[model samples]
Target chain A: MDLFINLAHGFSVALSPMNLLFCLIGALVGTLIGVLPGVGPVATIAMLLPITFGLPPVGALIMLAGIYYGAQYGGSTTSILVNIPGEASSVVTTLDGHQMARQGRAGPALAIAAIGSFIAGCVSTVLVAAVGAPLTKLALLFGPAEYFSLMVLGLVFAVVLAKGSVIKAVAMIMLGLLLSMVGSDIETGQSRMAFDVPELSDGIGFVVVAMGVFGFAEIIRNLENQSEETRSIVTSKVTGLMPTWPDLKASAGAITRGTIIGSILGILPGGGAVIAAFAAYTFEKKVSKDPSRFGRGAIEGVAAPESANNAAAQTSFIPLLTLGIPPNAVMALMVGAMTIHGIVPGPQVMTKQPDLFWGMIASMWLGNLMLVVINLPLVGVWVKLLQVPYRMMFPAILIFCNIGNYSINNAPFDVGMTAVFALVGYWLLKLDFEPAPMLLGFVLGPLMEENLRRAMLIARGDPMTFLYRPISATLLAIAVFLLVLAVLPMIRSKRDVVFVEGET
Target chain B: MSDGIQAPSGRSGGFRIRNQQDFYGGLVLVAVAAFALWASRDLPGMRGFAFGPGTAPRIFASILGALGLIVAVGGLVTDGPPVERVAVRGTALGAVLIAIFILVSNYATPITAGLGLRQYETVLAAIVVLLVTIAIARGADRGPLYVVAGTLVFAGTIRPLGLVLASFISIVVCAAATVEVRWRETILWAAGLTIFCALLFVYALNLPFNFWPRF
Candidate 1:
């Protein structure tokens, strides 16, 4: 009953003229950038952070959320049409989505993806609303020790779930923690690593690092394979705009199962959406009677992963909204946005600012609805936009990103800093180090340190407090278990098999 | 997996270093950790169980250093993929040259200031290095160099020259990053984008951006 009333209030807020407009704009711009290969949601959100500075907190958040869904939707479109997955989550989509396109069933593949995503979005939005309040309540049980332990678990989850060498991932996390310690200490106000630069006192801006690592580094990498300029775009006109009844019936079960998988995984602190899509597609294949049909124009392939990813994308917000912990880099950027708006994320947000909380939740549903309506009819437009060569597109992105960086603090030094990090990101790519874990570590570092210090002080310097507390101990135990599981050679091979997408 | 590591050190008559990526990557991490430790050396540490600013940093840095060492050792004992080759020679060289130039300029300030070129020294040095590096760099490798140069141009010019000129120059400069650039098309596109960005950011969004050069 309370959920109903709260949702009603949320609908009222989301339906407001200004909020709706922002949602629409966010969806459009998100799709626009997400359609472009090499730019992920992290960079998109970081680049657009400056634009949200002036917006009211609710509107700003709504817009950012809209951008996320739009970006994912656009990624599917790119996969189907160009066989180029816009980002990692969409990589599996290209397996069968593009196959469907090649077989001249591009329209049905796209329609099913959109429909599946919409259904998943609807289900997950409700799940988020339902789960958010209880999770916030659960958060009330957490002490400083518990919070610290939880963060440790979250980082471990990131490492275990991330596709890379476990040792390298752990190293990256440590490096991120080290980098996060650059600014002044919270308790003492004593600068740990300003290096005499005034700007360093604020610590490195998250936006600058994000734009540098994901944005500019991606450009550098994309430039590497420009010699293979052949992009096989499906020039055939997309005729059937809707999936047939049989296509719908075939994907119904897959969609439900995908939504379930995505919702569960999305709550975990890791690369939820990427793994969710992969897991969904793999599960679909495993359960199918004719598993061999998966990579060869199977509509279930397009439906399941798309649904899972969208569901995962939305439900990943659960951790961020409930516990004040961002599950991934994109959510970390959301934390930055919230901080900038003078709204601290956590359990308190629900009780203190119910309107903001519920309104953002409601806006997500509306945003999903908008994506379906805006994207389906606009598929041809997106396909046309895809024909724009990368050569011309990159410079525009570069200029805009530079301008965006400058706008953050009106500081040119930030621009220079971004260039440096871009170099670092490019170098990391060469070294086979995944930047995602490092980013998650950077986001959680200060919080973890603060909690650890508080817990220690409360326990009068006894390290045993973490072990003594049941919740904290459990979290730490799980983290260790996950770490061990990831390190085991047998599990590692299985993990690799799950991630292997058949590239034609 | 057993062939390389299980064999005696001199079995193949060589001390083979496997997994160069992890080896170098781990070494770099160790260096970074060391740098962090050095940077935080002055901050106070534990005072009777209470952390004094530096405790957390020193702790994490030490952990990172240990982890880095483990990775480096793993690289030695384990056989894995070799480091992927990337066209970073030009980019790396440019960075090295820039560092050298900055160090020399800082140390030899008296020499540079005597010529009344102190204010222009860094900027001039950067431009020259960028040009030389771009010229010498392979066609594919120039992307990052040109992109970096473009960003620096925007950073350097945005204040003095204002948004229009800064954005225009940066866009044009960045277009040269790829060999596929068509000059006329790029110039027109840059100009159009400059106008659009200036209007959107300055007028529509009303961010406090100057339209023309302050001077």
Candidate 2:
């Protein structure tokens, strides 16, 4: 079979001793950083960008890819144990995972997280093998307008799904768009907010803002709370290496459905892992025999989101590999890294580097296996990390904070900006202004501004063209429809929750 | 959205400078916008460079200032939820620690001179900051102040220390400063982590520069 032959070629490229070793190491670091509160995989991979400067591009990409997904697995660990979701995708996990922990069922919670992730990883890998080429072809239809519209839709969906006021969520998304535009104008090469600082010529780095806001701010907030009643969870003994037969059966079908659903969703521009996680949860809730079980500590709640997030993490690679468009921050950073290596991502990438493409894909399976093995044995270690007092652990996190901020360029100016932003982030956190949407604004703001300006210039400042251009107009139309409808879904959800609570 | 991070900003004074969150957010935005508007005098419209570099940032940052004002106004209009304020003691200590950060950050920039010496300056400053920070943390009634200050200072200095030294020291000192371990316990934890990172980053990973002396 062509699949077998191609996979064989892939394995040949992937199975080298050095490659295997790097895969394991990447998995280890990914998991470690995932356990650590502040730094996630995207920034870690970005921090290591310079290290890969001289290495072969294939090896570099393979390792970076490993770190990305491996962190996805590791992220769930903290969420399950400590109620701190290390990455955005894992936020849904905290709903039930932390609930299970408070009930002293932490062992089972962590086990399901690892097992669900592994199953989804395998299922997604198979999907990637079966449909990567075709999906890559499908992705060719998207242009800048499509990408922008898709982002708008995704943000609206996120706001729709977010557990907060709809007005605030919309405000957050708009805020995120605005914040993202704060740097230099990409098209016109105009400095948007650099203020003549050499370091800011590139704009505010997300890593600094994310770490400062989510990571540091979280710690500060936690410190202020007088609830000293953190109980130590004992999972030193794997009370259940295997999920009870009922547990396995309940999640098995959900995992399969989530993988399938996530695979298709991921191929769409802007539908990355976090979106996949939320979408899968929504799907599971809709199809559940008893929808009331969700949000109140349903095992399926954990299983579906975990599966979808990982599957989406893999499949989102379609656009990046095929058309060279990066739909998210991590992928954007990957684009920057690849551009540095002079290997343009597009159709020719697969052809010119069969070994690279196939090998990276093959390596993911092996990497997943390594993650399960390495992460499972280390679950007890991570659970114990929860026992480490905040007073003691806070300093070490700061050190990582410094290192991560510094590694962005080893420039003091970046460090200063991070502090400035951290203070700003802390203030926003206090004011009920969501920082995540601000980040979204920060990420997409510049792009949107650039594209808007370009369209204007092309039309000689004829603003009407934005509404008249077929592709752009359609996207804008869809964005408007979704934006307006975002709150409707929430009212439905609230009514459903109230009804469920009354019945229960 | 408050998620109980702050005891909802108290309704007292209706918008005191004491609310550090909106203060810095507003102050920074207003200051930066003022600077941008001042600097824009140098740029021409539709110059050879498709659009001059300052054109977009000035406009964007100005909007940021306006947004900040809106956010601040919102804060001023609302009463924070009822909860015990984070001990003013903790907030005051935080301010003191931040003052230390500003001193080091504003001064350390010129001191580094952008030479290779920047690494040493960053590391040494981080060390001194870490020690003083930890001492303050342990000695003061305030909690986690040292860790926050140390982190802020290190984040402030990291760019000067190349990735290797900065990351290594930042992790080492911050971990040392924050973790609630016995001195003997911390020394081992700190030394072991430092050595392990040194080997992994320097020897095995082969990143340039040997930060700690190898005897």
lDDT of each: 0.84, 0.60
Error of 1 at B162 (Å): 1.2
Q: Write the per-residue lDDT of candidate 2 for residues B13-37, one digit (tens) a residue.
A: 5535434444444454556556656
Q: What would the per-residue lDDT of candidate 1 be over residues B134-161, giving only the tens digit for each residue?
A: 6665666677777777777676667767
- What tens digits encode model 1's per-residue C-alpha lDDT throughout A177-200? 888888878998888788888888
Candidate 1, residue B113: lDDT: 70
CA lDDT, candidate 2, residue A227: 45
**Fnat measured on candidate 1:** 0.65
TM-score of the first chain alone, every candidate: 0.97, 0.78
- CAPRI quality band, candidate 1: medium
Q: How many residue pairs clash in each candidate?
A: 0, 26
lDDT by residue (A190-254, candidate 2, tens digit) is 66545666666676766666555555655555444524535444444545555678877888887
Candidate 2 local Cα displacement, residue A83, angstroms: 5.9
Per-candidate DockQ values are 0.58, 0.22
Instruction: For candidate 1, list the clashing residue pairs, or say none.
Output: none
